[model samples]
Target: MPDKDAGTPRVFLIRHGETEWTKSGQYTGRSDIPLTENGEKQVISSARLVVGPGKIINPSKITQLFISPRKRALRTYELLFDEAARHKFEGKVEITEDIREWDYGLYEGILPSEAKAGRKERGLDKGRPWNIWIDGCEEGESPKDIAGRLDRVIAKIREIQGPYMHGEKPVDVVIVAHGQILRAFARRWLGFEIGVKLPMMLEPGAVGVLSYEHHNVDEPAFLLGVNMAESEE
Candidate 1:
Protein backbone atom coordinates (compact mmCIF):
# COMPACT_ATOMS: atom_id res chain seq x y z
CA MET A 1 0.00 0.00 0.00
CA PRO A 2 1.12 3.57 -0.69
CA ASP A 3 1.89 5.69 2.37
CA LYS A 4 0.44 9.13 2.91
CA ASP A 5 2.27 11.80 4.87
CA ALA A 6 0.13 14.61 6.27
CA GLY A 7 -1.86 14.70 3.05
CA THR A 8 0.49 16.35 0.51
CA PRO A 9 2.59 15.40 -2.49
CA ARG A 10 6.05 15.63 -0.90
CA VAL A 11 8.84 16.33 -3.40
CA PHE A 12 12.39 15.05 -2.95
CA LEU A 13 14.94 17.04 -4.97
CA ILE A 14 18.45 15.63 -5.33
CA ARG A 15 21.73 16.58 -7.01
CA HIS A 16 23.56 14.08 -9.21
CA GLY A 17 26.70 12.19 -8.24
CA GLU A 18 30.23 13.64 -8.49
CA THR A 19 32.22 13.88 -11.69
CA GLU A 20 35.84 14.65 -12.69
CA TRP A 21 34.90 18.19 -13.61
CA THR A 22 33.03 18.65 -10.31
CA LYS A 23 36.08 17.60 -8.24
CA SER A 24 38.16 20.33 -9.87
CA GLY A 25 35.65 23.14 -9.14
CA GLN A 26 34.82 23.57 -12.82
CA TYR A 27 31.47 24.99 -13.86
CA THR A 28 29.55 21.95 -15.21
CA GLY A 29 26.69 23.81 -16.78
CA ARG A 30 25.00 21.41 -19.24
CA SER A 31 28.05 19.15 -19.36
CA ASP A 32 27.32 15.42 -19.22
CA ILE A 33 29.79 13.97 -16.72
CA PRO A 34 29.65 10.46 -15.28
CA LEU A 35 29.67 9.78 -11.55
CA THR A 36 32.71 8.62 -9.64
CA GLU A 37 32.58 5.26 -7.82
CA ASN A 38 32.02 7.04 -4.53
CA GLY A 39 29.07 8.83 -6.08
CA GLU A 40 27.28 5.55 -6.70
CA LYS A 41 27.68 4.52 -3.06
CA GLN A 42 26.37 7.87 -1.92
CA VAL A 43 23.24 7.48 -4.01
CA ILE A 44 22.45 4.08 -2.49
CA SER A 45 22.87 5.37 1.03
CA SER A 46 20.72 8.46 0.52
CA ALA A 47 18.07 6.33 -1.13
CA ARG A 48 17.85 4.17 1.98
CA LEU A 49 17.58 7.23 4.20
CA VAL A 50 14.78 9.05 2.40
CA VAL A 51 12.92 6.26 0.60
CA GLY A 52 12.69 3.80 3.50
CA PRO A 53 9.52 3.62 5.55
CA GLY A 54 11.46 4.41 8.75
CA LYS A 55 11.87 8.01 7.60
CA ILE A 56 9.30 10.62 6.59
CA ILE A 57 9.88 9.62 2.93
CA ASN A 58 9.04 6.33 1.23
CA PRO A 59 9.89 5.00 -2.20
CA SER A 60 6.48 3.66 -3.07
CA LYS A 61 5.17 6.99 -1.88
CA ILE A 62 7.18 8.51 -4.70
CA THR A 63 4.91 8.46 -7.71
CA GLN A 64 7.37 9.90 -10.23
CA LEU A 65 11.12 10.39 -10.57
CA PHE A 66 12.31 13.23 -12.79
CA ILE A 67 15.97 13.30 -13.81
CA SER A 68 18.32 15.58 -15.68
CA PRO A 69 19.59 14.23 -18.99
CA ARG A 70 23.17 14.65 -17.81
CA LYS A 71 25.13 11.48 -17.15
CA ARG A 72 25.74 12.11 -13.46
CA ALA A 73 22.06 12.57 -12.67
CA LEU A 74 21.07 9.62 -14.84
CA ARG A 75 23.59 7.45 -13.01
CA THR A 76 22.18 8.42 -9.64
CA TYR A 77 18.68 7.55 -10.81
CA GLU A 78 19.84 4.13 -11.99
CA LEU A 79 21.83 3.30 -8.85
CA LEU A 80 19.05 4.29 -6.46
CA PHE A 81 16.48 2.00 -8.01
CA ASP A 82 18.49 -0.33 -10.17
CA GLU A 83 16.48 -3.45 -9.36
CA ALA A 84 13.19 -1.76 -8.42
CA ALA A 85 12.12 -3.39 -5.16
CA ARG A 86 8.60 -2.84 -3.92
CA HIS A 87 9.66 -0.93 -0.80
CA LYS A 88 12.50 0.91 -2.51
CA PHE A 89 12.58 3.77 -5.02
CA GLU A 90 10.52 1.92 -7.61
CA GLY A 91 9.25 4.55 -10.00
CA LYS A 92 9.45 5.85 -13.54
CA VAL A 93 12.57 7.86 -14.37
CA GLU A 94 11.64 10.86 -16.49
CA ILE A 95 14.01 13.48 -17.91
CA THR A 96 13.37 17.20 -17.81
CA GLU A 97 15.70 19.65 -19.57
CA ASP A 98 14.39 22.52 -17.51
CA ILE A 99 15.84 20.77 -14.48
CA ARG A 100 19.39 20.93 -15.85
CA GLU A 101 22.51 22.53 -14.39
CA TRP A 102 22.87 26.27 -14.85
CA ASP A 103 24.08 26.90 -18.39
CA TYR A 104 27.50 28.53 -17.98
CA GLY A 105 27.40 29.63 -21.64
CA LEU A 106 31.07 30.26 -22.46
CA TYR A 107 32.18 29.39 -18.95
CA GLU A 108 31.32 25.69 -18.89
CA GLY A 109 34.10 23.15 -17.96
CA ILE A 110 36.38 25.86 -16.47
CA LEU A 111 37.49 25.83 -12.83
CA PRO A 112 35.89 28.42 -10.57
CA SER A 113 39.25 29.75 -9.35
CA GLU A 114 40.63 30.11 -12.86
CA ALA A 115 37.50 31.88 -13.99
CA LYS A 116 37.63 34.25 -11.05
CA ALA A 117 41.33 35.04 -11.50
CA GLY A 118 40.94 35.63 -15.21
CA ARG A 119 37.82 37.68 -14.72
CA LYS A 120 39.57 39.63 -11.97
CA GLU A 121 42.61 40.32 -14.16
CA ARG A 122 40.21 41.54 -16.80
CA GLY A 123 38.34 43.51 -14.11
CA LEU A 124 35.22 41.44 -14.71
CA ASP A 125 35.22 39.96 -11.23
CA LYS A 126 35.05 43.39 -9.64
CA GLY A 127 31.63 43.70 -8.08
CA ARG A 128 31.26 40.15 -9.42
CA PRO A 129 31.02 36.92 -7.42
CA TRP A 130 34.02 34.60 -7.11
CA ASN A 131 32.28 31.25 -6.63
CA ILE A 132 28.74 30.45 -7.58
CA TRP A 133 28.45 29.07 -4.01
CA ILE A 134 28.14 32.21 -1.87
CA ASP A 135 28.37 35.05 -4.37
CA GLY A 136 25.77 33.85 -6.91
CA CYS A 137 26.30 33.39 -10.66
CA GLU A 138 28.10 36.02 -12.73
CA GLU A 139 29.20 35.05 -16.28
CA GLY A 140 27.09 31.91 -16.50
CA GLU A 141 23.47 32.71 -15.68
CA SER A 142 21.41 35.51 -14.13
CA PRO A 143 18.97 35.20 -11.24
CA LYS A 144 16.11 35.77 -13.64
CA ASP A 145 17.16 32.74 -15.70
CA ILE A 146 17.44 30.61 -12.62
CA ALA A 147 14.16 31.86 -11.25
CA GLY A 148 12.38 31.42 -14.56
CA ARG A 149 13.48 27.82 -15.12
CA LEU A 150 12.86 26.88 -11.53
CA ASP A 151 9.37 28.28 -11.87
CA ARG A 152 8.71 26.23 -15.01
CA VAL A 153 10.04 22.91 -13.70
CA ILE A 154 8.23 23.37 -10.40
CA ALA A 155 4.99 24.23 -12.17
CA LYS A 156 5.41 21.12 -14.26
CA ILE A 157 5.90 19.04 -11.14
CA ARG A 158 2.84 20.61 -9.52
CA GLU A 159 0.75 19.64 -12.51
CA ILE A 160 1.97 16.04 -12.27
CA GLN A 161 1.22 16.01 -8.55
CA GLY A 162 -2.50 16.19 -9.23
CA PRO A 163 -3.13 12.45 -9.87
CA TYR A 164 -0.98 10.55 -7.29
CA MET A 165 -1.48 13.30 -4.72
CA HIS A 166 -3.26 10.78 -2.43
CA GLY A 167 -5.46 13.09 -0.40
CA GLU A 168 -3.29 16.00 -1.56
CA LYS A 169 -2.67 15.93 -5.31
CA PRO A 170 -2.55 13.05 -7.76
CA VAL A 171 0.83 11.55 -6.73
CA ASP A 172 4.13 12.26 -5.05
CA VAL A 173 7.05 13.54 -7.18
CA VAL A 174 10.78 12.86 -6.71
CA ILE A 175 13.22 14.84 -8.85
CA VAL A 176 16.88 13.89 -9.40
CA ALA A 177 18.57 16.87 -11.04
CA HIS A 178 21.58 19.17 -10.44
CA GLY A 179 22.71 21.28 -7.49
CA GLN A 180 21.82 24.65 -8.97
CA ILE A 181 18.33 23.52 -9.88
CA LEU A 182 17.81 21.94 -6.45
CA ARG A 183 18.89 25.11 -4.66
CA ALA A 184 16.72 27.36 -6.77
CA PHE A 185 13.82 24.91 -6.49
CA ALA A 186 13.97 24.81 -2.71
CA ARG A 187 14.42 28.57 -2.40
CA ARG A 188 11.54 29.44 -4.71
CA TRP A 189 9.15 26.72 -3.55
CA LEU A 190 9.90 27.15 0.13
CA GLY A 191 10.16 30.93 -0.24
CA PHE A 192 13.23 31.27 1.94
CA GLU A 193 15.37 34.42 1.86
CA ILE A 194 18.03 33.27 4.32
CA GLY A 195 20.44 31.96 1.65
CA VAL A 196 19.44 33.98 -1.37
CA LYS A 197 22.92 35.37 -2.03
CA LEU A 198 24.55 31.98 -1.66
CA PRO A 199 24.53 29.28 -4.33
CA MET A 200 23.72 25.95 -2.62
CA MET A 201 25.87 22.82 -3.16
CA LEU A 202 24.83 19.20 -2.71
CA GLU A 203 27.03 16.19 -2.08
CA PRO A 204 26.85 13.75 -4.95
CA GLY A 205 23.72 11.70 -4.13
CA ALA A 206 22.44 14.16 -1.54
CA VAL A 207 18.69 14.67 -1.14
CA GLY A 208 16.69 17.81 -0.37
CA VAL A 209 13.00 17.54 0.34
CA LEU A 210 10.55 20.39 -0.35
CA SER A 211 7.04 20.11 1.09
CA TYR A 212 4.09 22.48 1.20
CA GLU A 213 0.67 22.86 2.79
CA HIS A 214 -1.63 22.72 -0.25
CA HIS A 215 -1.02 25.90 -2.29
CA ASN A 216 -1.12 29.61 -1.59
CA VAL A 217 0.62 31.65 -4.26
CA ASP A 218 0.53 34.79 -2.05
CA GLU A 219 2.24 33.41 1.05
CA PRO A 220 5.45 31.38 1.46
CA ALA A 221 5.10 27.73 0.42
CA PHE A 222 7.01 26.29 3.39
CA LEU A 223 10.49 24.69 3.47
CA LEU A 224 10.68 21.14 4.82
CA GLY A 225 14.47 20.67 4.52
CA VAL A 226 17.64 21.11 2.43
CA ASN A 227 21.22 19.75 1.78
CA MET A 228 20.61 16.27 3.25
CA ALA A 229 23.42 14.05 1.89
CA GLU A 230 24.33 10.37 2.07
CA SER A 231 26.77 9.02 4.68
CA GLU A 232 28.43 6.41 2.51
CA GLU A 233 31.40 5.73 4.68
Candidate 2:
Protein backbone atom coordinates (compact mmCIF):
# COMPACT_ATOMS: atom_id res chain seq x y z
CA MET A 1 0.00 0.00 0.00
CA PRO A 2 1.12 3.57 -0.64
CA ASP A 3 1.84 6.03 2.16
CA LYS A 4 -1.30 8.08 2.36
CA ASP A 5 0.13 10.49 4.89
CA ALA A 6 2.99 11.40 2.57
CA GLY A 7 0.63 13.09 0.12
CA THR A 8 2.00 11.19 -2.83
CA PRO A 9 0.53 11.75 -6.28
CA ARG A 10 1.16 9.55 -9.30
CA VAL A 11 0.68 9.63 -13.04
CA PHE A 12 0.17 6.48 -15.05
CA LEU A 13 1.73 7.02 -18.44
CA ILE A 14 0.45 4.42 -20.86
CA ARG A 15 1.66 3.96 -24.41
CA HIS A 16 -1.12 3.13 -26.81
CA GLY A 17 -1.41 -0.46 -27.98
CA GLU A 18 0.32 -1.65 -31.11
CA THR A 19 -0.78 -0.49 -34.52
CA GLU A 20 0.09 -1.55 -38.06
CA TRP A 21 2.73 1.18 -38.07
CA THR A 22 3.99 0.15 -34.65
CA LYS A 23 4.32 -3.49 -35.74
CA SER A 24 6.29 -2.40 -38.81
CA GLY A 25 8.48 0.06 -36.91
CA GLN A 26 7.09 2.97 -38.89
CA TYR A 27 6.83 6.51 -37.62
CA THR A 28 3.19 7.05 -36.62
CA GLY A 29 2.86 10.72 -35.92
CA ARG A 30 -0.26 12.68 -36.99
CA SER A 31 -1.43 9.75 -39.08
CA ASP A 32 -4.17 8.41 -36.79
CA ILE A 33 -4.05 4.62 -36.97
CA PRO A 34 -6.11 1.90 -35.35
CA LEU A 35 -4.84 -0.91 -33.19
CA THR A 36 -4.32 -4.31 -34.68
CA GLU A 37 -6.29 -7.32 -33.40
CA ASN A 38 -3.36 -8.55 -31.35
CA GLY A 39 -2.98 -5.11 -29.87
CA GLU A 40 -6.56 -5.18 -28.65
CA LYS A 41 -6.09 -8.58 -27.00
CA GLN A 42 -2.89 -7.42 -25.35
CA VAL A 43 -4.49 -4.31 -23.88
CA ILE A 44 -7.46 -6.26 -22.56
CA SER A 45 -5.24 -8.67 -20.66
CA SER A 46 -2.96 -5.92 -19.42
CA ALA A 47 -5.82 -3.75 -18.25
CA ARG A 48 -7.36 -6.56 -16.24
CA LEU A 49 -4.06 -7.52 -14.70
CA VAL A 50 -2.72 -4.09 -13.84
CA VAL A 51 -5.68 -1.75 -13.30
CA GLY A 52 -8.10 -3.34 -10.86
CA PRO A 53 -8.30 -3.27 -7.06
CA GLY A 54 -4.92 -2.86 -5.37
CA LYS A 55 -3.39 -2.87 -8.80
CA ILE A 56 -0.83 -0.45 -10.23
CA ILE A 57 -3.67 1.80 -11.36
CA ASN A 58 -6.69 2.00 -9.08
CA PRO A 59 -9.58 3.42 -11.07
CA SER A 60 -11.20 4.96 -8.02
CA LYS A 61 -8.22 7.12 -7.31
CA ILE A 62 -7.91 8.53 -10.80
CA THR A 63 -8.89 12.18 -10.98
CA GLN A 64 -8.35 13.01 -14.63
CA LEU A 65 -7.54 11.20 -17.84
CA PHE A 66 -5.75 12.88 -20.72
CA ILE A 67 -5.64 11.16 -24.05
CA SER A 68 -3.87 12.07 -27.24
CA PRO A 69 -6.01 13.57 -29.96
CA ARG A 70 -5.62 10.42 -32.01
CA LYS A 71 -7.85 7.44 -32.50
CA ARG A 72 -5.15 4.98 -31.50
CA ALA A 73 -4.77 6.66 -28.13
CA LEU A 74 -8.52 7.03 -27.62
CA ARG A 75 -9.05 3.36 -28.38
CA THR A 76 -6.30 2.35 -26.01
CA TYR A 77 -7.88 4.46 -23.29
CA GLU A 78 -11.21 2.79 -23.97
CA LEU A 79 -9.76 -0.68 -23.70
CA LEU A 80 -7.75 -0.02 -20.56
CA PHE A 81 -10.71 0.86 -18.42
CA ASP A 82 -13.98 -1.02 -18.39
CA GLU A 83 -17.42 0.56 -18.45
CA ALA A 84 -17.64 0.54 -14.65
CA ALA A 85 -14.33 2.28 -14.26
CA ARG A 86 -15.23 4.76 -16.95
CA HIS A 87 -18.46 5.56 -15.18
CA LYS A 88 -16.58 6.02 -11.94
CA PHE A 89 -14.35 8.48 -13.74
CA GLU A 90 -17.38 10.65 -14.52
CA GLY A 91 -16.29 12.13 -17.83
CA LYS A 92 -12.78 13.23 -16.91
CA VAL A 93 -11.45 12.28 -20.29
CA GLU A 94 -10.15 15.11 -22.42
CA ILE A 95 -8.56 14.57 -25.80
CA THR A 96 -5.79 17.10 -26.16
CA GLU A 97 -3.05 17.85 -28.67
CA ASP A 98 -0.49 18.31 -25.94
CA ILE A 99 0.07 14.59 -25.55
CA ARG A 100 0.15 13.70 -29.24
CA GLU A 101 3.10 11.88 -30.76
CA TRP A 102 6.14 13.77 -31.94
CA ASP A 103 5.61 15.41 -35.31
CA TYR A 104 7.82 13.22 -37.51
CA GLY A 105 7.30 15.58 -40.49
CA LEU A 106 9.06 14.30 -43.59
CA TYR A 107 9.88 11.15 -41.71
CA GLU A 108 6.24 10.32 -41.04
CA GLY A 109 4.97 6.87 -42.14
CA ILE A 110 8.53 5.66 -42.68
CA LEU A 111 10.86 3.47 -40.69
CA PRO A 112 13.91 4.81 -38.90
CA SER A 113 16.20 2.88 -41.23
CA GLU A 114 14.59 4.53 -44.22
CA ALA A 115 14.96 7.95 -42.65
CA LYS A 116 18.63 7.31 -41.98
CA ALA A 117 19.18 6.00 -45.48
CA GLY A 118 17.54 9.06 -46.99
CA ARG A 119 19.66 11.34 -44.82
CA LYS A 120 22.78 9.42 -45.74
CA GLU A 121 21.94 9.83 -49.42
CA ARG A 122 21.68 13.57 -48.87
CA GLY A 123 25.06 13.53 -47.08
CA LEU A 124 23.31 14.81 -43.99
CA ASP A 125 24.49 11.95 -41.78
CA LYS A 126 28.17 12.70 -42.41
CA GLY A 127 28.88 13.95 -38.94
CA ARG A 128 27.31 12.55 -35.73
CA PRO A 129 24.37 10.67 -37.18
CA TRP A 130 20.91 12.13 -37.70
CA ASN A 131 19.47 12.38 -34.24
CA ILE A 132 15.84 13.40 -34.07
CA TRP A 133 16.42 15.01 -30.69
CA ILE A 134 19.07 17.41 -31.90
CA ASP A 135 18.61 17.56 -35.67
CA GLY A 136 14.81 17.12 -35.57
CA CYS A 137 13.11 16.43 -38.88
CA GLU A 138 13.26 18.58 -42.01
CA GLU A 139 9.77 19.95 -41.28
CA GLY A 140 9.00 18.69 -37.78
CA GLU A 141 8.91 20.32 -34.40
CA SER A 142 12.21 20.53 -32.54
CA PRO A 143 13.12 18.93 -29.22
CA LYS A 144 12.71 22.32 -27.61
CA ASP A 145 9.15 22.49 -28.90
CA ILE A 146 8.33 19.08 -27.42
CA ALA A 147 9.81 20.13 -24.10
CA GLY A 148 7.73 23.29 -23.97
CA ARG A 149 4.45 21.54 -24.73
CA LEU A 150 4.97 18.73 -22.25
CA ASP A 151 6.00 21.19 -19.58
CA ARG A 152 2.58 22.76 -19.83
CA VAL A 153 0.94 19.35 -19.45
CA ILE A 154 3.04 18.68 -16.39
CA ALA A 155 2.06 22.03 -14.95
CA LYS A 156 -1.61 21.16 -15.41
CA ILE A 157 -0.99 17.84 -13.68
CA ARG A 158 0.53 19.62 -10.71
CA GLU A 159 -2.35 22.02 -10.57
CA ILE A 160 -4.87 19.19 -10.63
CA GLN A 161 -3.11 17.29 -7.88
CA GLY A 162 -2.38 20.32 -5.74
CA PRO A 163 -5.60 20.23 -3.74
CA TYR A 164 -5.02 16.61 -2.81
CA MET A 165 -1.34 17.08 -1.97
CA HIS A 166 -1.92 17.88 1.68
CA GLY A 167 -2.73 14.27 2.59
CA GLU A 168 -6.45 14.71 2.19
CA LYS A 169 -7.24 12.45 -0.78
CA PRO A 170 -4.82 10.63 -2.98
CA VAL A 171 -4.82 11.98 -6.53
CA ASP A 172 -3.83 10.01 -9.57
CA VAL A 173 -3.88 10.90 -13.26
CA VAL A 174 -3.59 8.87 -16.42
CA ILE A 175 -2.21 9.74 -19.85
CA VAL A 176 -2.90 7.61 -22.88
CA ALA A 177 -0.46 8.71 -25.58
CA HIS A 178 2.09 7.55 -28.08
CA GLY A 179 5.51 6.04 -27.34
CA GLN A 180 7.97 8.85 -28.13
CA ILE A 181 6.00 11.66 -26.55
CA LEU A 182 5.20 9.72 -23.38
CA ARG A 183 8.83 8.70 -22.98
CA ALA A 184 9.90 12.29 -23.47
CA PHE A 185 7.18 13.36 -21.05
CA ALA A 186 8.63 11.00 -18.46
CA ARG A 187 12.07 12.53 -18.92
CA ARG A 188 10.65 16.04 -18.64
CA TRP A 189 8.63 14.98 -15.61
CA LEU A 190 11.96 14.29 -13.97
CA GLY A 191 13.48 17.58 -15.16
CA PHE A 192 15.55 16.18 -18.03
CA GLU A 193 15.78 17.41 -21.59
CA ILE A 194 14.67 15.31 -24.54
CA GLY A 195 17.47 13.17 -25.95
CA VAL A 196 18.55 12.41 -29.46
CA LYS A 197 19.04 8.88 -28.27
CA LEU A 198 16.01 8.04 -26.18
CA PRO A 199 17.12 6.75 -22.78
CA MET A 200 14.27 4.32 -22.24
CA MET A 201 11.79 2.06 -23.96
CA LEU A 202 8.07 2.49 -23.42
CA GLU A 203 6.70 -0.48 -25.28
CA PRO A 204 3.26 -0.57 -26.83
CA GLY A 205 0.57 -1.25 -24.19
CA ALA A 206 3.09 -0.67 -21.43
CA VAL A 207 2.40 1.32 -18.28
CA GLY A 208 4.94 3.53 -16.53
CA VAL A 209 4.60 5.32 -13.22
CA LEU A 210 5.90 8.79 -12.45
CA SER A 211 5.68 10.27 -9.02
CA TYR A 212 7.57 12.34 -6.43
CA GLU A 213 9.96 10.79 -3.98
CA HIS A 214 8.74 10.93 -0.38
CA HIS A 215 5.61 12.69 -1.55
CA ASN A 216 7.58 15.84 -2.25
CA VAL A 217 6.51 17.10 -5.67
CA ASP A 218 9.85 18.90 -5.93
CA GLU A 219 11.56 15.52 -5.96
CA PRO A 220 9.95 14.01 -9.02
CA ALA A 221 11.15 10.53 -10.02
CA PHE A 222 10.36 7.66 -12.31
CA LEU A 223 9.52 4.24 -10.89
CA LEU A 224 12.09 2.56 -13.08
CA GLY A 225 11.88 -1.05 -14.26
CA VAL A 226 8.89 -1.92 -12.14
CA ASN A 227 8.05 -5.60 -12.19
CA MET A 228 4.57 -6.35 -13.51
CA ALA A 229 4.46 -9.56 -11.50
CA GLU A 230 4.61 -7.60 -8.29
CA SER A 231 2.17 -5.04 -9.62
CA GLU A 232 -0.29 -7.87 -10.23
CA GLU A 233 -0.71 -8.20 -6.49
Per-model TM-score, in order, reads: 0.75, 0.91
Off by over 4 Å in 1: 1-5, 53-55, 85-92, 127-139, 162-170, 191-195, 198-201, 214-233
Per-prediction backbone clash count = 9, 0
Superposition error at 126 for model 1 (Å): 3.5
How far off is residue 168 in model 2, in Å? 1.8
lDDT of 1 by residue, 1-233 (tens): 53223455567777787778767878887777888887777888877766554454555456677778888887787776646543354446567777788877656888767767776777764664665544445556766667777788677766676454334433557788887668777787765542476455667787766665444323335444432432111
lDDT of 1 at 141: 73
Q: Which stretch of 10 consecutive residues in model 1 shows the poorest summed lDDT?
A: 224-233
What C-alpha lDDT does candidate 2 achieve relative to the native structure? 0.84
* Candidate 2 residue lDDT tens string, 24-121: 99999999899999888878888988887777787877888989989989889889999888888877887899999999998999999999998888
Lowest-sum lDDT 10-residue window in model 2: 224-233
Candidate 1: pairs in clash: 133-199, 161-170, 162-170, 163-170, 164-170, 164-171, 165-169, 165-170, 165-171
List per-prediction Cα lDDT, in the order shown.
0.66, 0.84
